[model samples]
Target: MMPQTTEMADKLDVLDRGSDGEQRSQPDVTAQSSKVSPLDVLKTDLPAGLVVFLVALPLCLGIALASGAPLFSGLIAGIVGGLVIPLISRAPLSVSGPAAGLAAIVFTGISALGSFSVFALAVVIAGVMQLVLGVLRAGGIAHYFPSSVIKGMLTAIGVLLILKQLPHAIGLDVEEFGAMSFQVGKENTFSLIARALEVIQPGAAIISVGCVALLVFWDKVPALKKLTWLPGPLVAVLGGTLANELFQRNYQTVALQSEHLVRLPSTDGAGGLLGALHLPDWSAITRADVWTLAVTLAVVASLETLLNLEAVDRIDPWRRKSPPNREMLAQGMGNLTSGLLGGLPITSVVVRSSAGVNAGGRTKAVALFHGLFLMLAVLFMAPLLTRIPLACLAAILLTTGYKLAKPKLFSDMYRLGWSQFTPFMVTVLAIVLTDLLKGVAIGLAVGLAFVLRESMSRVYEVSREGQLVTIRLNKEAFFFSRGKLVSLFEELPRDTHVILDAEAAPFVDHDVADAIRDFQSSAGLRNIQVEVRGLKLAPVAPG
Candidate 1:
């Protein structure tokens, strides 16, 4: 027999080769097939679902509060987003819910439409529009957005999260969490913070700071990393709840009131759940303003969904690319269901998706489980959920926000040079100053300007050796490049042999070709020799 070491080495070599062969054979397996067995779902997705449920609960309520809609409406949207959208979406890791980005739109739409029920009708109409958009394959528009702008959008959202959550973290809970727009009501983001400072609660402040500290420690300490089964956010919530109880019992002066905690509508049974579902006002269907709001919702919701889908796909460990059109169809169906149920409009949300991903969610089962958890909590655990403090949730979001807008992100963008950094900074500033869609538009415009400048600069190449000037045209010359071509002709040295080469160019615009012809015609007057080749000009139009 061989020596023990040699025998073990041989076995290892065989195992290594087998591993390599498996990897090579299944290179596309993750993208092509994302289905998980029930056993796998129970082991991995259940825990992930619980984590997402914890994150989604507070956000759902907060977004509804920010939108000026009934709190139950947000839960309805979250439920539908979790239950319906994942069934149709091709993205395995993406989670859908009520979006903070649409809070301002919903707030304004409700006022314009006269009632929440009427706004629900607009949401239904928007859902139909999304279905039409999916049918028309408009989801491909997401591919046109620049990477810089998308990164900026994510970073800006992070900054907004930190700013918005500060008040809640410090126990100054007047405005809701998740409002990203610079201005909300009589107070803007800064004004709200200023107001919160005037009535800050010391107990809430202590709890929030302690929760943040725990989260930071848990994230950094390797010893704590081993206890991954218990999510840090959940622990923070528990700690905050216990701390609040102690404060109420002992430090009565600084105790957090009921207003400072989650307040899910308590329901008795199936009847209560059914009774909570609100229906849209069918009479509002004929109103022109309803249609206008519907169109706006459809456009904005679709765009947000597509953007989040792209962002989530990029971060997915499997690197699977989602079909954008299918995602739109899923979101459309989800919105339709939500609107019919008196829920807020739904979109694929970055925060919930990020939480799911961080929790090791690998299949749509995670979303399904989270939805079930939401339903169960509303039905059974509403009282317990209410005990959790807003400060704890704020701490969780603070960590998330820090992840998104880390200082390294800015440094990385700067390293990419101004072409990337300019649009990124502009997008962040614009979103912070204005809103999401407008900010993205501004970034897109800036990105397009850079594209045009680059295109114009590369129209042609000019070289002169010993007075022999050669103007070699690029692959295509457009009207935008005509001025440069004309300038080149005028600047050529007198009596020099000038060669205008177009043989390499695939196509030349009519205006540019005309300019070239005029230059050739004028060369004789200047006593200059001109050689032209390979420019097949378009036939002149008859007058």
Candidate 2:
């Protein structure tokens, strides 16, 4: 991964210079990068799909249980996300399914509706809303979110995952298992952590610690990196499962228990796939709750799909950018189909997508293969797969969570300034306290507040020893700061000499233009002499 990052940078450097017309080197080693053929794509995709299948297996069951849905609903969603997306998607590689982020929402909805059928209805409505969003081509609205906020969101997700999984990773099942809290109810993460310190499940804890260490070491080991043909998660999950079995057999210690099992519904044959059907709530369409859920689902699912698409493309050796709008349509179709079949709503998942890419997946064929594997697993390996411990899944999630919440991620955000850190930290807190959507809303609100506050603060007067008063826009001025601009104009004393110097303004928004237009029209009323500098009058676009 480290070498790959450097390689990407070098590729970007060369790609940026195409316009220079400078004397170039020989026929392209890099141009060949774009020569990925149908056969090559298929070969890469099939193995990649298998890798995704392994990772997705545990996740599908876990997420379905977390969402208060039938276990098979998750698998159904996974199959649809993996199988149907290739038809409409422009994304070279993206594996979609039930998301951890949406679990809380599903839980809340199920609790309120009092039935999985009602929740499925909500999902269907959400799918329709997403289809409408695709028709409107509003998927690009995600671009309006600042890069800083997005980074903060990703970082927050990482921290939340770490906190949520820590208890499970360390073998402590408290009141809140998959929780993200410094504190919650009478006890929080720290309290449970304190308990973990006192009464460690010596056997389970040891296995988890060993699993984490092995995964970390495997990533750093060079020789093993070549054997990267086998994904790190795959090794860790399989190894942990086997280790649990050995521990039970040898030491009479079992970390693998019924509560921690991936329960597969009992069935005689392949017919079980057809037996695992969920019907939607036909009456839910008339309810306001369904409408609300539809909007939320569409928004969250679309955002996840777009972000995952971006991340997958970044990891692609070929660096192909996915079309966001087209991907949105595919997701809508996938969700619709899945919901119809009594399955959970599907979205592009980073976990399996990363697994697929790491396993040398080059095309959508990998996703299709994964779906095929998932369908076949029910017929062949259902009983065996059911034996895999939930602790093993926790280990995989723990490893993934650590990568998100690494120390460097925090340092990077802090270095970016308060404008970045405020949203970033708030996002973490929000995810911990509430759920994903509410957390994101709170963080976004903070970011917007930061913008507005900075805009207002730019109005402070500067003392210049001259007849002319130099009005300077502050370092962080945006269009939303126009009220400050207007207020400054209003506060200017009669007959004052003034210079409006916007050279210091890093950004000028439409409100600034409006304020300027208002000032120019009313300059005579104030009896103030004003001179402007660095005023680029290009009309600002409405966001």
TM-score of each model, in listed order: 0.87, 0.79
> Which has the greatest TM-score?
1
Q: Write the per-residue lDDT of candidate 1 for residues 379-474, one digit (tens) a residue.
A: 889888888888887888888778778787787789989889999999988888887778888988998788777778998898888868888987
Candidate 2 matches the true fold with a TM-score of 0.79
lDDT of 2 by residue, 1-543 (tens): 112345545655564211011223322233225455565655456656776787687678777876778888988888888778777887777888888777877778888877888778888878877888888897787676655555555556566666666666666654333343344557766677677667666656766777778877877887865453465666766787788778778876655565455566666675766776778879777888877877788888888677656646644555567878888888888888888888888888766765676555766777888888887786788877776665555666666666656676677679889898888888777866665656767887898888778657755456555556677775656666676668777877777787887787677677676677668657778787766678756443554
Among these predictions, the greatest lDDT belongs to: 1
Candidate 1: 10-residue stretch with minimal lDDT: 15-24
